[model samples]
Target: MKATREAYGEALLDLGRLSDQVVALDADLSKSTKTSLFAKEFPERFFDVGIAEQNMIGIAAGLSLAGFVPFASTFAIFASGRAWEQIRNTVAYPSLNVKVCASHAGITVGEDGASHQSVEDIGLMSIIPNMTVLVPSDPIETKSIINWAFKYKGPVYVRLGRMGVPDLLPKDYSFDTKPYIFKKGKKIVIFATGIMLWKCLEAIELLKAYDIEPTLVNIPCLKPFPEKEIIEIVREHDMVFTAEEHSIIGGLGSMVASTLSRSYPMKVSFIGINDKFGTSGKPNDLLSFYGLDAAGIRDKLLDNIK
Candidate 1:
């Protein structure tokens, strides 16, 4: 239940039960993205568009126009890049209700390296018009947000991690897509997403050891990055650090800083890739190599706090 695949699988079943209008399309990634649950339960509602990611989105758009709520699934890169034009014109431009469900996002898709990895997917989707991008922190939150996308209008890009993520949400917890503050603090705010939540947890422990009780905000929904909530948190804390396992250019770090500067100004530091392509290393090795681990965050915190 803690793995993202389980949440996607369970939530698709829940969505299928809740709405007769719900239909799914996948580009030969049924097993990977867990859309097979829906495919099995409602074969008629499921469309396996073969390995055609572009056709997948285009068909999903057609389904939307036909009054069916289409949730498209594939690896992040192909969904965003392979079918980006179709998504932009057919879905986003028209403001259609389509959920682009993506998996194996970020460096978490280790060993596969940069080729299969999708470090830029979040930035790519969030920039599109009428797109509500989501990067859920854990399995429970993944379910909550995917359920949110079900009821949410317009186009949505859901970026899901491939690895087994720790459950950061309380059992029987509720989530509002606007903004849900997992932990609050006075000095520093840790705004983290996907794969990097575990790092934030470790940083929290290290910070507590150093008497720096920081706030940890597990930001799954990155596109509509809780604008008001972020500004308030920034004002409440001495400083805020945006952390994610992505390049700082257009990832969570960049998104947070952009929101803060316009809505509310706050001292912010970014903790992520120093604008580089990730190498084919062990996950832990990659994290340490890019200074995105617990110790990396701790060091960045110390540097900025003083």
Candidate 2:
């Protein structure tokens, strides 16, 4: 098992070696965000904007304007919540090449409590114009997405987790803006993102006893959403469920529901944190408390499909 943030650190190192213009900025969170790896190697190119998330974003925007691809890092809460205006105006509005890679997102942030956990970051980033939002399910996908973000122009927000997750993708996997199918089944479809994909995989095993097989889809890209593909797949299914370690209000659940409501119009239910903030606890316990674990998901599926 490996955390996606670790892969992000490794990817940043690779980018540093590949390009001179690839600069990293952190809000005095180099170690936590793993930008320390890049700083250690390229001190001159790395900037630690001391406990100032907003200033880090503004500096990144300036770097982008100077023809440098700047990757800014910090906790999801501060990156999206604290520095929101700078990101929306300085980076996104101009369609600059700034990659805002926020770590420790969702309920899995653990022990840090409600104030640190950022279940709304995805929604915040997605709502902005010219911003691309991505949630990588595993370490491999995380690395691929980071590499892709560096190459793609404009503002991009890649949400990363703190907890370790089982590697689900192949070694040869490449990143793209499409949903990945992990299993094929009839009538029902379960769309999941981030660490929730692993939970859904676990739930699928429990569901097998009842012959309740659902087509499992991993949605790594949440913005500029895979709407056409989602509509096509939803049309083939009887029931739909979107799972995420985020709030049901404006995260993955909202995106999927909004898309289908306009095009396919299906009964879409969600398995995620409701209208509540995350509390301090073990990651697994927090997931269970929010009905985001394997068993909770299984129960939700069984209850909803009936």
TM-score of 2: 0.99
Clashing pairs in 2: none
Worst 10 residues of 1 by lDDT: 173-182
State the lDDT of candidate 1 residue by residue for 83-195, as single tens digits.
Answer: 89899999999999999988877776777787877778888888887888887778887888888888888999988877787787896766676555667777778888876
lDDT of each: 0.83, 0.93
Candidate number with greatest lDDT? 2
Scored against the true structure, residue 158 in model 2 reaches a CA lDDT of 96
Candidate 1 stretches greater than 4 Å from native = none
List candidate 2 stretches off by more than 4 Å.
none
If scored against the real structure, what TM-score would every candidate get?
A: 0.94, 0.99
- Clash number for model 1? 1
RMSD of 1: 1.8
What shift in Å separates residue 202 of candidate 2 from its native position after superposition? 0.6
